[model samples]
Target: MVKLIALYRHPEDQESFDKHYEQVHTPLVEKMPGLKKLEVTRIQGAPMGGEAKYYLEAAMYFADRAALDAAMSSPEGKASAKDLMGFAGSLVTMMIGEVSREG
Candidate 1:
């Protein structure tokens, strides 16, 4: 599997960011053609007892890199990308990678 991971820095307004993310951004992301699964996490303090650098993290899974690329090039993907610029651009860092799981 391949995944697109998004790390969100602390925003100026957490409430507003949460609202928009839940209400608008998530729906847009769900529209991607090859999206297999979506996972989100709210970061708390670091294990060492300091504040976390990231406020949130999201992972979007796909079958492979090709599927991921296709999804990102689709219309829904374009819309999601454009929407990110409106609110989360400066606060976000994104990456794509293969996933490994072991039981």
Candidate 2:
């Protein structure tokens, strides 16, 4: 399996970001051809009880790397990417990796 991990930093306006993410961005992500699952988490604090480095995390799961690549080149994927860059380009960091082991 392969996945794209997105780590979002604290936005200038949390309410607006949350609203747009839930209403708009999420739907766009759901349209991708090879998307198996989308898991999102809101980061609250570090283990030591202070602020965490990231505000949120999103994991987009795919069947494999080829599926991931195909999804990235799809029209739906292009739209989603545009939306992401329009809204959170500066505040988000994304990475792609394979799952070596999972339960």
Candidate 3:
């Protein structure tokens, strides 16, 4: 499987960010054609009792890189990408990678 991981740093307004993320952004992401699963993480803290650099993490799963590419090339994907610019652009970091499993 391939996944698109998005790491979100703390935005200036936490409440607004959370509201928009849950209400608007998630729905847009769900519209992607090849999206298999979506996982979200609320970061707690870093090791050694320091602050965590990121506030939230989202993993969007696809069957493979080709599926992911197709999804991103679709109109829904474009809408999601454009929506990111509406909020929290500077605080987001995204990456795509293959999933590795260990038994």
> Every model's Cα RMSD, please?
0.9, 0.6, 1.2
Backbone clashes in model 1, listed as residue pairs: none
Ranking by TM-score: 2, 1, 3
Ten residues in a row with the worst lDDT in model 3?
94-103
Candidate 2 lDDT for residue 40: 99
| Stretches of candidate 1 exceeding 4 Å from the true structure | none
Model 3 lDDT tens row, 29-78: 99999899999999999988888999999999999999999999999999
Off by over 4 Å in 2: none
- Model 2 worst lDDT run, 10 consecutive residues: 94-103
lDDT of 1 by residue, 1-103 (tens): 9999999999999999999999999999999999999999999989999999999999999999999999999999999999998999999999998888823
lDDT of each: 0.96, 0.97, 0.95
The top-ranked prediction according to TM-score is 2
TM-score of 1: 0.96
Q: Residue 67 lDDT in model 3?
A: 98
